[model samples]
Target: MKEEIKKHLENAITSYHHYYASGKLAAYIPALLEANPKAIGACILDKEGHWYCAGDYEKRFTIQSISKIVTLALAIMDNGEESVFSKMGYEPTGDSFNSLVRMEINRVPKPYNPMINAGAIVVTSMIKGEDNNEKLERIIDFFKRLTSNEELSIDGKVYLSEKETGHRNRALAYYMKEVGILSLDVEDVLDLYFQQCSILVNCQDLAKIAMVFANDGVDINTGEELVPKYIARKIRTIMVTCGMYDASGSFAVRVGLPAKSGVGGGIIALSPKKLGIGLYGPALDDKGNSIVGMKVLEELSRKLDLSIF
Candidate 1:
């Protein structure tokens, strides 16, 4: 059964790789302009610890917005859910991932949830550290544990480029500071946020991390708690409700998995007790999610009975 499932997934990946070149790579961030717009990869880790990879699974990609999951995980591990929720939020708002409607309407102005950009900036500040370096290391360490890989770190070029052009994130930071929701210095918090987004991982590493979530935060091999079970559940719920930029609802309907995507053409999604999957393709839709990646997931869901509901 495992081998047959793997073959079907690989065939699907091969059939879909060409679709990436026909779409748009996110060009607003100049650093992302050069990714082979034609590239894609997919990997799945089943509950039994077997690995299956297809297409460019080894291709290196930055996590980009997908790092929100990492930073949020770190904040939960350090501060516990209660403290983290007090500052950010939990409900999903139907706005752009970076939209600030709540800040404009609500007294506090933080967004509806931590999965979006504003809430993510707030979550970034929640990590307990005296300085940015310490905070960043904690995030990195968390990623290492999730992926079981020690070498994960920021892509220097992507980090520099994003830092150079992160004006909107800067605005979110300052406004969050203005409302007193964000307790850290605007500059310091922005620095850490940028650094976190630049953390690099490929499809397989992301799949391994997703496997931890698939197992409800227990590492199958080590029987260790990488994240508290409820914490993992909360994060995955957010992923289902708000992980895709503006298309999260539609994605949930079509793909039926709790997943998160990044502008870097990377997505980490998982089927509980079944598989954790990662897909990458540099081309993007207007909402900043990978176009081919989304299609691949939709097809995978239809064929594999992987949807949650």
Candidate 2:
């Protein structure tokens, strides 16, 4: 089975590698522009401890918006569901992930969901910490545990790039602050958010993290509950509904998995008790999802009958 999955993965990479030409790098971050736009990779971990990988699975990239799921999980662990959900709704916004229009038009002005930039900033503010350093430490620690990689760290260049070019994010944070949705210092929250988004990861690291979610918040090898079952369910539900930004509805129809995509050309997908799949393809379509990664998953899902729907 492992060999067969690996063979399929290799074929998928070969078939979709040229799709990179149809998409573009996430050039807005500047640091991300250095990524090999043609690189494509995947890694899969099954519940029985089998592993399969192909292509550039070892290549590293920033976690990007994928960090939002980790922060949201940590915030729920820090503050219960009620407190966390009070700051943002769980519904998907058809607008862009970074859109501020909803906040402006709504009477309450809170972010629609934690997966978006505004909602993720609000969730970061909810993290319990005395300072940004402590908050970031806790976040990094959580990520380390999730991926089972103690060496996971931020890419300093990407962190600086995000900090310098995040004007739109700053506007969202400050607006949320002014509207009473955020009680914490806006800069501190933004710093933590930016730092989290810049953490480095590879396809293997992402597959391990997804495996935990596949097992309903428990570590597959150690049997430790990393996240409570309810919280895990909540996170997966949100990922299905909002993880793909404005294109989520179409992605749901095409792939039918609980998954999340990062602008760094990575996607983490879950197949309940069966498999945790990680894909990386930096070339992005207009919606900011990895175009090659999307095609790879669609092919795998259809071939393996892995979709939940």
Model 1 per-residue lDDT tens digits across residues 1-309: 687778878878877777776689877678989898888888888888888888778988889888888788878888888888888667778787877666789866666888888889888888888799888888898899999999898888888888898888888788888888888788888888888888889998899888888888999889999988887888889899889977998998888899999999999999987788988888988788888888888888988888999
Which runs of model 2 end up more than 4 angstroms from their true locations? none
**lDDT by candidate, in order shown:** 0.85, 0.91
TM-score of 1: 0.97
lDDT of 2 by residue, 1-309 (tens): 677788788888899899999999998899999999989989999999788999999999999988888889999999999999998998999999899999999988999999999999999998888888898999999999999999998999999999999999999999988999999888888888889999999999999989988889999988999999989888989989999999889989999998999899999998888898889999999999999999999988888888889
Q: How many backbone clashes does candidate 1 have?
A: 1
What C-alpha RMSD separates each model from the true structure? 1.2, 0.8
Give residue 208's lDDT in candidate 2 (0 to 100): 92
TM-scores, all candidates, are 0.97, 0.98
